[model samples]
Every structure is written in C-alpha cells, then in structure tokens.
Target: MEYQYPFSYDWTTQEIIDVIKFFEAVETVYEKGMNRDEFMTFYRRFKEIVPSKAEEKKYCNEFADSSGYSPYHVVKKMKESNPGDFVKMES
Candidate 1:
C-alpha cells in the first residue's frame, strides 16, 4: 500500500526537481503566458512548500507535455484536491 499525504513517506532530490518543473509549468499556465517574475515567485514558493531536499514528488507525472506524467497516478491526485482551481481557473 502507498503512504497517504499529511503523512508522506519519503522524497528524493529527483522527485523534488520533477515537482519544481511541474510548478514552473503551472506558473506558466497560471500567468497565461511566460512571465519570468511570476515563475520565479511560484518557484520560490514551491521550494518552500516542499518539506525538505529529500522530498517526495507530488504531481510526480501529471504534466501533459512530459512522458513521466502517469495517467493513473495523475488522475488519482486530481481526484484528491484542487477541486476547481486546475480547470475553472486558467493555468
């Protein structure tokens, strides 16, 4: 069985990077275009959100552009939170 959130198991550096990239993408979308300032802000916040360097990757493989975004896994995560923010709100 997999460990659930608020109780994440463990994380690795690669996982952290993957998530960071994900956020960067999201920021791009959120901004409605490429905004370096907004991206840096999101990136900084994302870094703060991750508990540690040995961090677990949430949204590990959900990016449509990336091959790693596993559909099953991404769907599961989508089912959890982010009720409307992802769609209702652009980016």
Candidate 2:
C-alpha cells in the first residue's frame, strides 16, 4: 500500500490523478469489490492516458509487483462478467 503508482512525467497533473484513481479502483477490486461500470470508467480513462499496450503492460506490471494486486486479472474478470455486476477478486 506504500508503493507509488506508476505514472509518466509526460502526463498532466489531472492525468496522473486519473491514473492513480484507476489504480485505486484496481486495489478496491482486490480489497473488497467494485461496480463493473464504475471500474470500467476508471479503466477507460486509464486507457486514454495510456493507449499503448506495451506501456500499459509496463505500468500494470509495476503496480502488480508493488501491490501484489493484478490489474490485468481484474480487467479480465470485469470483461468476462455481465453488465451491472460487481467485480471482485481474490486478494
């Protein structure tokens, strides 16, 4: 939890905040549960900020390494679930 979220200096302040928010949602998925649509909104914004697959993977890997929470798994679960469902992951 003390780990810093991965971010690029090239991003604006708001972009950094949005990226942090997305990572927080990923944490929420592991810590408790998050609404599918809500988490998706954060993820959509994250994707907008990090459009490159390689870059996204890098950040995701960094976050996973630090927090032991896998954003990739959370996103995959959300994608595989039905609309209006709550997404939860094993911590």
Candidate 3:
C-alpha cells in the first residue's frame, strides 16, 4: 500500500489497470487468500502486457522489495495447486 505498482510508460490505460490488478492479486495472497483460477486470470493478463521473463522478474522483484510479498512464490504455488484451490503466502 505504501508503494506504487511497477509499470511502463508505454502501456495503455487498460494495460496499466490490468497490471495493477495482477499485483493486487499477489498482495491478496499474502494478506488473505485468492482462488487459483482468479489469480491465474490476472496473471495471464499481466503476462500479456509483460511477456518477457526478465521484465517480469524486474517488476516482481520491485514489488516484493516494496511490499514484502513475493509474486513469484504465489505463482509457484498457483502452478502447483489444482483449480479452485486458494493460494496464500506467509513471509
């Protein structure tokens, strides 16, 4: 909440919103919990906006540094979980 979401100046308004939603979903995993399907939906949109793995790592690392939530870990859990399962993170 104290830090802004990492984004690109070239992105469209909707793309920026979608990226924020994706970060919010990551935050939700640490704060409460998010369903795997819902998280994946946002994540898919995020990947569409930032298709590069290096860029994804940069943004995710920035967010994690500011918020203490790791998008990578949540995503790893999502990949390991079945659909409808809730993803949550502690740390």
Candidate 4:
C-alpha cells in the first residue's frame, strides 16, 4: 500500500491500532477473503471507536480515497452474507 491509513487525532494509541485492524480486514476482503466472524470482530471494535454514522463515513471515505478499498462495500457484503460465509470483493 502506498498510502497511510486514515486516522483521527482524537483516537488513543489502541484505538488507532484497532481502526487499522479494521481497515486491514477490509483490505483482506478485497485481496482474498475474510471470515464473517473475524471481519465482524474488527467491525464491532471499529463501531466502538466510531459510533456515529457521519464520523464513520468520514473515516471510511478517507481510507477509501487513499487505499482505493471501500470499507462501506465490505461492511455491506458482510451484512448481506450468512454466518460462516466469506466476505470478498473485486476492485
């Protein structure tokens, strides 16, 4: 990846790490595939850090702009899939 992960100055060190992990999971979905449960774990933690939909959109947009990976689409696929399904995307 040529770009840095989007992050907020207000986040703590651990929060930043968790947010990065969430982005990484998104990356995994596009590059290969990720387990629904594993991706959900990251997504849940991401929600904890960014509870507001507006704020979440801001972060996701920034990440997508830099990385060309859409977190929104990944989350959408995850929500649409059943348990034990893999989340995958093609860009």
Give TM per candidate.
0.31, 0.98, 0.96, 0.96
Over the stretch 39-62, how does candidate 1's per-residue lDDT look in tens digits?
A: 344445555656454442434333
Model 4: per-residue lDDT, tens digit, 1-91? 7989988899999999999999999999999999999999999999999999999999999999999999999999999999899768988
Give every collision pair in model 3.
none
- Score candidate 1 by TM-score against the native: 0.31
Give the number of the best model, judged by TM-score: 2
Cα distance off (Å), candidate 3, residue 21 = 0.3
lDDT of each: 0.41, 0.95, 0.94, 0.94
Model 1 spans with C-alpha error above 4 angstroms? 1-32, 54-58, 62-91
Q: How accurate is candidate 3 locally (lDDT)?
A: 0.94
User: Per-residue lDDT for 87 in model 3?
Assistant: 72
By TM-score, the better pick of 2 and 3 is 2
RMSD of each: 12.1, 0.6, 0.8, 0.7
